[model samples]
Target: MTIPLADDVFRAPGVELFDFPPLWEGAPYWLTKPVVLAVGGALVVCALAWAAFARPTLVPRGMQNAGELVYLFVRDQVARPFLGKDAERWMPLLLSLFCLILLWNFIGVVPGLQFPVNAHIAFPIVFALVAYVIKIYLGIRHQGLAGYFKNLMFPPGLPKLLALTLYAPLELLYTFVTAPFTHAVRLFANMFAGHLLLAFFSAAGFWLLHEQPSLVGAPVGVLSVAVAVAMTAFEMFIQFLQAFLFTLLTAMYIGASLHPEH
Candidate 1:
């Protein structure tokens, strides 16, 4: 959404947080700032990966050092506990997912690129769809078709007769339906709400002082700006956490898919 900057100090700033127009008159229906940011974020990840690993050395330096920290963070925190010895097998996927998501979310705080791509439902849905497909494919490959459904719909923890009648449909519904819905919505919803909140406070800051027409609201405007700045910091931490969680959940889903019976 475009911030309505007041031309005059006494004019009210608009707070339209969810409305955006096409970047250009001739642009395609899907072309918008968020789409550009999503593509840009992906390119940034590729460039960073290339810079880090393009010319490998025995001793890490510059971007490689930073990249290694990120790689190890994902490998240790995201992969090892979930995949165990298979961790290294999937390091490439997990690491890429983590970095891509982190960059996507981190763009929200960047000066010129304040929009988070994941705020657009399409972006998160695409990633979730990929993960969902991978999950089902892995499950079928490892457990066999019938075994996969059996393991999923007929979990062993529940009583046999009760499980057949009660938990079976619930389990199927959760795995087949609710899981992916929540998966995409969680990221999209958070980014959507967060960006709106930041925009609201920022517009309030300008509106109170510029549009108030008196000194009475100046202090409130200052307070609004202060709160906006504070929320931005908190938003950064939340962005990181959300990226980590999305990757972590992806790993968990894949792991369960691969070992459904276990």
Candidate 2:
């Protein structure tokens, strides 16, 4: 379910009286908030790339250092371990996914940008679809269609009956349904829940301060502020964790498809 922000939650006392419009109006066709956010996020990542690597340096500094650190982290921690000898070819894709997701997740923490792009299902869905297509493409490219189906549906050390009754259907479901669903929902749910908690505490604080103008209100506001601060820190950690988890899972899936024997 989509959580609603309180009327005054995102507003400062003397800010202009522009109402927060619904992200969509008609049949959700073109240029929704999430779409705009996603596009903006892509642009931000591209800009970062240009700033970081456009000018090569022997001793990387600033954006270059940050970008290289992220690249090495994803390359060493995610792709290499999973994809083994074939990792170098895929490192760029995984690095791009990691950075994009990290940026999208952290956008909520930026002032005046109150929502994480991944909290919207559409963003995750698009990413998951891309991952799925890559997986299928890799599988088909490496193994012929016959072998791909064999690897997908028929595992080693399984009896023929068991393979037919259990493994085949399970693999089909995972390949066709569960994998993408979980991949998309994992990121979506994390951001959605984190944002909801932040909104709740922030709004609660405001409501307490405004609705109850007594000594009690001050304490409640203070408590709410504390919780908001705590949740912000927690959300920061979660933002990174979700990006790492998504990239790691994608790497693992790619690894499995590329090397099904292992």
Candidate 3:
């Protein structure tokens, strides 16, 4: 009698359920992929920033020109409008955040570098936490702790009972939770979903072409390629939009913290 192996125990060795691995994998202390990407991206941004602004120029050239445009965009469009008189002081920080995030988002779309650093939640969470800290610090610096809390939780002119019931929860949700959570997740979710969808269709096209081995799969693959291109263009727009949105929300939060009455 011939012996048989269990189907579950014996299977094709090379088949994978999905083409890509899960986002995270267990690893030794220093080898985590997300950490590497975060550090690498940060270093690259820093280097670019240094190169861009190392030597001040009367007339900008190359990276300097690009950097100046980005700075003006953030300062004029985002910081100035929201922060007003105080915007000039915060221009550098705001511009850095915008460029860092914009670079990370666009890096995902580059061929051969498929992973978006922001698609991983940790990076965004860290940035959001920083924003939270800055907002709270500025709020307290501008208004003493008691005054800040009052401004936040008990805005003047509202009935005491209504303030307690309505304003408290709203303030708590907006400040302590929703602000950071939404700010971080908005970019993370967009990049994550966009990349996943692109991967799915692109891989499906390849699989169809391989399995069918005929002209039938060719058209489908062509359509998939077209869609992938379209989605890439859309992703570029989203990359810029998300970066700007993140910076804008950050400016708004800072503005609120600085002048909580508004």
RMSD of each: 2.4, 4.7, 6.6
What do the candidate models score in CA lDDT, each in turn?
Answer: 0.84, 0.83, 0.78
lDDT of 2: 0.83
Off by over 4 Å in 3: 1-30
**Residue 221 in model 1: shift from native, Å?**
0.6
Candidate 3: C-alpha lDDT: 0.78
Candidate 2 regions exceeding 4 Å error are: 1-29
lDDT per residue as tens, model 3, 1-262: 0112232232221212212333457555545555666677789989988989999799999999988888889999999888999999998789889988988888777777666778777788988998999999999999999988888888778898999998888988888898899989998988777767666566655555554445866888678778878988898899899999999999998998887766
What are the models' TM-scores?
0.93, 0.88, 0.86
Candidate 1 residues lying further than 4 Å off, grouped into runs, are 5-16
Model 1, range 1-262, lDDT digits (tens) per residue? 3456655553333324445668989888777787788888889999999999999899999999999999999999999878878889999998998888888988887887788888878888988999899999999999999999888877777788888898888888888899999999999899888888787788778778776545888888899899989999999888899999999999999889876654
Ranking by TM-score: 1, 2, 3
Lowest lDDT sum, 10 consecutive residues, model 3, at 10-19
- What is the Å distance of residue 20 in model 2 from its true position? 8.0
Native-structure RMSD, model 2: 4.7
lDDT digits (tens) for residues 190-250 of candidate 2? 9988887787787667666765445857897879879988999999999999999999989
